[model samples]
Every structure is written in C-alpha cells, then in structure tokens.
Target chain A: MEKTNIRTNKNFNKVSDIIESLTINTNPDSVAVLEEIGTNSSIDEVRELTSRALVKRNEHDSLQVVISNRGKGINDMSTIVAMSTINELLSLENKEEAMRVLENTISSEGFDEEVKENARSVKALMALS
Target chain B: MSAIEKVNQLSHRIFNTSKNEQSTSRTSNPFAASNFQKNILTEDVFESSKSKEANKVNFTGNLSASSKRIYSVFVGSINDIGSRISSGIESIKAFGSRMKEGIVNTCVNTWNKIHEIGNKEESLNGTKELLGRDITTFFVNKREREISKMANMNPHMEVKSIFKDALQALEADMVQVA
Candidate 1:
C-alpha cells in the first residue's frame, strides 16, 4: 500500500510537470493534457485549471458536460473550483444543471463551511439572475 | 461445646491447615537482571530519528493537490500577463507623445468592458472599481513621468488617455476565469 502511494505520487508529479510544460509553451496539446487531468485527476486545482483552460480554448460545451458529471461530492475547495468552472459555462440555459450541482454541494457535509457558503451565494446569484 | 474446647478447636484449625501446594510465582524485570547484557553503555540505541521520506508529507486528497496546482498556474499566468503589460508600456514609452492618445483610449475601453462583464453594482461598490481607478492612476502617472523625462509636455488629455488605454489592456489581458 505504501509503495502504491509513493508510485501514485510520482505519477501525479510527472503529469503535473507535463501539464505545466504544455501550458508554458502555449501548445495546443496542453488542452488535451488539461482535459485528461480535469477528468481523471482527483486533484481539484488541476481540474479547475483544465476547466478554465478549456473554457478559454472555447471548449465550453464539453466543459459543461464534464462539470455536470464530475462536479459531485464537492467539498469547500472543490465547491470553489466547481463554482468558478460553472461561471465560465457562458450559456445560461445550460447552466441550470451546473447550478444544481452547486446547490447540492451547498447541502453536502463533505464541503467546508466557506465552500458551502460560496455555493449558497452563487446559488443566490443564480436565483437573482 | 464448652469455651475451652472451642478455643482449642480454633487454634488447631488455624495452625494445622495445609498450605496450598501451588505457590505464588515471582516476576523479574528483564532490564534489571538480564544474563546477556551488552557491555557498551550508550543511549544511541534508544534515540530515534525521523525518516526523510516520512517527513516529506504528500498532499493527497482533492483540495490539497488541486488547489496547489491551480494556484501555481494562476500565479504564473498572472505574472506572464504582467510582464506582457510591462513590455507594452515600455514600448509605448519609447514612442513618447505619439502613442499617448492611443494608450488612454485603449485603457478606458478596457475598463468599460471589465465593468460590463463584472456586475455593474459590484463594479461600483466593490474593490474592482477601486482597483480599476488605481490602475488607471498608476499608468497615467507613469506615462506623464516618461513624457516629462523626454522633455516633452504631453497634453493632460493625452496623459489621461494613455493611462486609460494601459488600464484597459491590463484588464483584458488578465484571464477572467471566474
């Protein structure tokens, strides 16, 4: 188990380096790397970056689907990431599902108080809009 | 029975009762009476050191790794934008008064876009407005100084315009992920 942990850490580090390099180079390949990390990596920051990068690259539709699918079980930090990603969705009609996810996160005990609070606030903003 | 007989019987019972064959076992401390003790007298064997790998704690879980990577990339991207802005300003500085009007127009337009995208109420009541103002002021002052250094009296309008331009560029260049 310990060895597995060590190996996993190494893999994360390697992937992280690759992603950073792609981003730094502004290579189109970075989008694929980001997408992979966003979907597969358990890390929220990595996912956030992937989502943001995807949005910037005009991959909004796919990003929305990804967020809808994987944006569950959000804790406080993941809530922030999820909210930020959701905000970038661009399409108001499509945002309802993502917003619902945030609403669920607000009620979820796994998230920290701040995340829940932010989720609540984002939900409120949605209600107002 | 008579008292004297009772007394005699009690004495006999007390004195002649058979002792239990099983005796209570005695225990000894191993440290106190070990037969094969080491001759060397040092506390090094008892002293402990933490492993390096153990000390290097891995931030495992969702928030830990994700937040860290996101933060790093975010900061890096910001720096990249800042450098780009600084370089633009430097080039404008070289162009002197000729670029002043263009710079201000650009900054003001950028500010308007930022205001539009961000909630108007928040832009007015929030830090964004203050930040936008400060940024505008900074570029205005910077451009004014550079123009003065060239011994050129750039019109006040031109200075304001250029400052606005720079501020707009700054806002546009800043990745609005949220």
Candidate 2:
C-alpha cells in the first residue's frame, strides 16, 4: 500500500470548499469532485463532505436526475457515486421508491448482471428494514 | 347394304377398336403408324397418372391414422428439442456474463477501499498531536442532523441501534482526538 500525506489544513480547506460548492451550486463537476474525495481521500472530513453534499444534492435535484445518473451504467465513477448517494438517501426512508429503483436496475437490460445482483442485495437489505 | 352406311360403320369400328388395341398391343394401328398410338398412350399415362399419383401422396387423407400421428409427434419433438437447447444456451451465456461482472466489481470495490484506507493511514501518521479538538468538531457537526433524523423519523429499533453504534464510534473518535 502506497501511503500519501495530506496536510490537515489542506484537508480542512478542501472539505470547506466542497461544502461551499455543495451549498452554493452543484453541477456535475462539483458532484464529481466530492465523490472523488469521498472515495479516494483518507480523511473522514472529506467523506463527510461527500455525505453532506449528497444530502444537499438529494434536496436540490429531482428524482429523475438521480435515477438517470444511476442508469448511466456502472462503468463510470460518476455512476457509482450517484448510485451510492441514491442508495444512502433512499435507505434512510422511501422504501417503496427505493425498491422501484432497485427493480428497474435488476430488470433493465442495460445494467451489468453483477450490478443488478448488488441492487438485489440492497433490496433485500431494505426488506429487513 | 348401302355404300355410305357401310363406310360409316367401318369408320366407327376402326376408331373404337384402335383405342382398345393400343392398350393390348404395341402395334395397335397396322397401317396408320404404331408410333403415333404409342406416343398418345405414353402421354396419357405419364402426364395424367403422374399428377394423380402426386396428388394422392400429398394429401394426408391417403395416410393411415397411426402413421399420421407418428409423423406429427416426430415433428413436434424436433421443435421442442430445438427450443429447449436454445433457451439453455441463452441462460448459460447469461450466467457466464454475470459471473464476469461480479468478479470485476468485487476487484474494483476492494481496490478502491484499500487505496482509500492506505491513504488515510498515511495522512494520520505523525498526526496524533493535531487531531483532538478538530476531529471532535467535525464529527459532531456532520452527524447531528443524521442522528436526529434517525431518532425522530424512523421508529425501527434496528435502525436506531445502527445509528447509535455509528454515533458511538463518532464519540469514540472525539474522545481519541480530544
């Protein structure tokens, strides 16, 4: 494993920047950046930034945008990010709607079978909830 | 006998007798040419009977009931086997593709998680001094809304316990950092 150093102030500034961007305007690029930091950075603050951004995004964007972004296929990082964000938010509540999205993912011809199976697992998890 | 009446009787006998003679003998017309009568008979049997025999063979009504049933079952089984083989191959292909996808995603997720943790561990190295109050402030602010939502909106005990565990981890982090 390759270890990389990120200064504490730099991490704080990046998190602040992400929070600022998420609060002010959430374009695809901003969403992309937050997701990158969340998945790549070792800092919990950065992941929290991503979590917060997703919450903000869920509030600002339409469900169609979330679903469309998710259905763009799983090969892209953005799609994974969108999926994780949607999954997190939908898991909080909205069981029926989440199940609907999971079903669409499972049944749609475009998604990878593994991704569909992952969605199935998520659906099963939701059922427990 | 009158001359015209005898000629007419001779003409009827020759024409009628010639057709019957053509069936019985190869040389039916002794003087009028045997090949012409043979040609006519060949055409009548070959062209007419050929079509009649073909028609009879084509109609299933000519076949026995048991033979017809056997033929029907044979054709039906061939169709059934063809469809079953095709569907079986399709499902196998689908299963193979799914296995490939699962392996790929598993590798990808593992790689991402490992890299992220490695990077975090690297950053945290020698940072035991800077973490206390700063980390406390971060988790406290970040989790407040989430914890409140889980406590209020959702009534499930499992969900509450999960949130409580997460909150406990944050508090543990806060204690370590502070």
Candidate 3:
C-alpha cells in the first residue's frame, strides 16, 4: 500500500510538471491545467496567487526600465517612459494601451457622434493617469 | 428535438425530483431548514461585517466628495514645481553657456591687450582656467533638486494603507475558506 501511494505521488508530480511546462508553451493546455488545479485547490487561493504574480511582473518591468535608463543623462526620456509605464500598469480597465490607441485611431478619422459617445464611455471606464 | 435539448430536459427532471426530495426532507425535519437558514444568516452577517470594515478603511464618503479636489490641487502643485525646476535648469544651462562665451570673449580681448604688452602666454592660461570653472559649475547643478524630488515621488506610500487593508482582507478570506 505504501509503494502504491509512492507510485501515485510520483504520477501526481509528473502531471504537475507537465502542467507547468504547458503553462509556458501551450495556451490551451495551460488553461486546462489552471482549471484543473483551480478545481482541486481553493479557487480564492489561485486568484490571490495569480494577482500577486501579476503585481510582481509589473514591478519587475518597471525596475527593468529604471535600471536600463540609469546613467544615460537623459532625464526627460527616462521620466516619460517611467510615468507612461506606471500609468499603463495602474490603469485597470484598459488592460493594455488599447483604449488610448483606439481613441487616437478613431479620432484621426472624422468623428461620428455614435463613435464619439462610445469612445467617451470607454475612456471614462479606462481612464489612465 | 436536438440531442442536447433532450439531455437538458432529462437533467431538469432529475434536478426537480432531487429538489422535491430535499423539500420533503426539510419538511420532515424542522431543525434542518432552521439550521440551513442559520448558516445563510451567518454568511450574510459575515459579508456585511467585511463590507463595513472595507468602507471604514476606504474613507468612502470623504473620498467621494473631496478626492477630486485634493488630487487636482496636488497635481497642480506638482506641475508648478516641475515647470519651475525645468525653467531653472534651462536658465542655468543658458547662463553657463553664455558665461563660457563671455570668458572666451574676455580672453580674446585680454589676449589682444597682452599681445600689445608682449604677454600672450599668461593671458591664454588664465582664459583656460576661467572656462573650465564655468563649465564645471554648469554641469554640477543641472536640475539636481528636481530630479531628486521626482525620484522620491516614485513608489509612493500614500495609498499603502489601502493596499495593506486589501491584503489583510485577502488573508481573512483565505482563512475562512480553509
């Protein structure tokens, strides 16, 4: 029975390793593993861990910008990049620079009233600093 | 009927039967429904307590009324400081560049004067020293304070309490789940 338990544990470890590798290489497989793990683990635990991971990733990106831009003697360039990157991260609803880019794209063409109203709402929902 | 629709109908009947059985069991045991209701009430109480705690920390009412006012003033102040610092740096650079030009001009004038006196080498050395000092001063003080202030403002701790409270709430949620 102990040997059987050992075997089962090894199988579980193998599955977990496969899942981890899949998370980097295959989007659908990663989602499947995430779902499986989410069902097996506590749902809130998964969400909290994911949230922390996202925050850490954002911090890492910000730090990378600072480190790379240091000693360049170009303050304005560094300041603008840092501010824009932070604003992008802190802007919750827009997800990416999509809303800003979309607004610019739409406005370059003459504004239709309907499109303008939609853009306005989107901007409000996804306001950046 | 489609296969999916037929399967759904069958599932619905099964669900109804299970629900009926549950209701019959509840009717038979008076304590069961009361216990279930008690659990529901407890859950609602917990949720309300959590919400109240969140609201207290958030300063929700004060925030709604005065946040915009405070932020606009804060931003305006920062902008004013920033512009002043930028202008000051620019002015300093201009002044330094001008001073360097002035020194060179003065050297040229002195060189002409000393050449008349047959002392050209002495005047040339003096001009070099003057230009070097001016350039050093120019580069040394370029927006130093402004850059320091900007760096200080990064990773602001103003909303740290809110983040702490959020983390605390998450921990509490994890504990409850466990």
Name the runs in model 2 displaced over 4 angstroms: A1-9, A16-52, A55-91, B1-178
- Model 1 clash tally, residue pairs: 13
List per-prediction Cα lDDT, in the order shown.
0.50, 0.52, 0.43
**Residue A31 in candidate 1 has what lDDT?**
45
RMSD values, in order shown: 47.2, 31.6, 57.6
Stretches of candidate 1 off by over 4 Å are A1-32, A72-77, A90-129, B1-178
DockQ per candidate, 2 decimals: 0.01, 0.01, 0.00
- Write the residue-wise lDDT of candidate 3 on B1-178 in tens digits: 9999999999998776653346545343344334564352222222355567878786436565578688878989999999999999999999998999999999999988878676657667778888988888775454344333322331223222322343355445445545
Q: Is candidate 2 or candidate 3 better by DockQ?
A: 2
B1-178: candidate 1 lDDT, tens digit per residue: 9999999999988776533211111222223222235432222233223433544574443457678789889989999999999999988876875577688779989988887877777756778768888999997676555434422323232332333343333233332312
Show the colliding residue pairs in model 3: none
Report iRMS (Å) of candidate 1.
Answer: 20.3
Provide the TM-score, chain A, model 2.
0.48
Predicted candidate 3 versus true structure: per-residue lDDT over A1-129, tens digit per residue: 232342334333333333223223222333323333322332233222222222223333322221222211111133333233334434444344444443553465554454444444445545634
Measured against the true structure, the TM-scores of the candidates, in listed sequence, are: 0.22, 0.27, 0.17
Tell me the TM-score of model 3: 0.17
Q: What DockQ was computed for model 3? A: 0.00
* Top candidate, metric lDDT: 2
